[model samples]
Target: MSEKIRSQFGCSKMMLPEHCSMLREQALAEYRAENNRFPETDEQLREEQQYILDEARAGGKTVIIKTLNSNGCNHYMGIPLRCDSTGNKIIIRTETGPDLSISAAEVVSLTIAD
Candidate 1:
């Protein structure tokens, strides 16, 4: 007998672990509303984040940092303020009007408001 063919399929690369287009759409809409536009779908936000990170460490640059929340449940975006050598950790002032320090290594998602 021939081997059975697979019926169900699965996705490989994804923006989120689980499919959450609704949540993603909501977030995108909010971003558009805030910046009057949307970020490029090239998924290059991480690069943008890195560029901003470098600028921040060098001093004086506005950046949006997507960092893991303290609750270990969700992510948040903020503008970096200061940093130490190698940019392992940075102090960022969030759009919500507060300062926070997030680890660069732990942060994989981020965006530049450009």
Candidate 2:
């Protein structure tokens, strides 16, 4: 007589636990690389980003800022308040939350909010 197939465990092929976890990690890394691109690397790009920030500050326009850090990238939208003399840090007044203070070095990109 032929052996019966198990109901709980399907008859399909199985992968090792370690291999499955490794594949998951690889997929996550690829996604992060594509989505979380490194901010401006060259001097010219950095200057352009700074220009956008300055314009937003001057015109009192709401700006969307993307910052990158060790943890990950963060997105903030608000009106610029002020920056230190050296422009090392920036302050933004948010609508729903308390003022957010961000480090200039972490800023990746900026855009005027609609």
Candidate 3:
């Protein structure tokens, strides 16, 4: 037995203006949240940041590196293969792809994965 009143409204061709506006606002909010909209600091806090990275690399522990990029905040989880201060980058061995070399300038935070 099918109920005629229970029509599927998924992906309707038409949408109200209010609905469109609401969706636009929601998308903008999500973009800001994902990008870490906080003001960027001029100081990189290199010494403190490097200390955390060194600890993780020396212990051979998996770490989560949160980086801020033009697209947004990207998260990389893996064991660090190398930390090159002179080159201003760190290479990480991820399970799904080739080792990633992330610039120190883009790094927002680094934490050991539990």
lDDT of each: 0.60, 0.83, 0.81
For model 3, what is the C-alpha lDDT against the true structure?
0.81
Model 1 TM-score on a 0 to 1 scale: 0.40
Q: Which candidate is the best by lDDT?
A: 2
Candidate 1 regions off by >4 Å?
1-49, 56-62, 68-73
Better of 1 and 3 by lDDT: 3
Candidate 3 lDDT by residue in tens digits, 1-114: 334345455434488999989999999999878666644544456676677778888998888988887777789999898988799889999878899999878887888899
Whole-structure CA lDDT of model 1: 0.60
Give each model a TM-score.
Answer: 0.40, 0.63, 0.60
- TM-score of candidate 3 on Cα atoms, chains taken together: 0.60
The worst-scoring run of ten residues by lDDT in candidate 1 lies at 1-10
TM-score of 2: 0.63
What range of 10 consecutive residues in model 2 has the weakest lDDT sum? Answer: 1-10
Q: Which residue pairs in candidate 3 have backbone atoms (N, alpha carbon, C) closer than 3 angstroms, thus clashing?
A: none
lDDT (tens digit, per residue) of candidate 1 on 25-109: 8899887566543334343755666676777656654566544433343365556666654867767777677788777655646
- Against the true structure, whose TM-score is highest? 2
Across 1-114, the per-residue lDDT of candidate 2 in tens digits comes to: 223355434446598999989999999999988777665567887788778778988999999988898689899999898876486888998989999999888887878898
Candidate 1 has which clashing residue pairs, if any? none
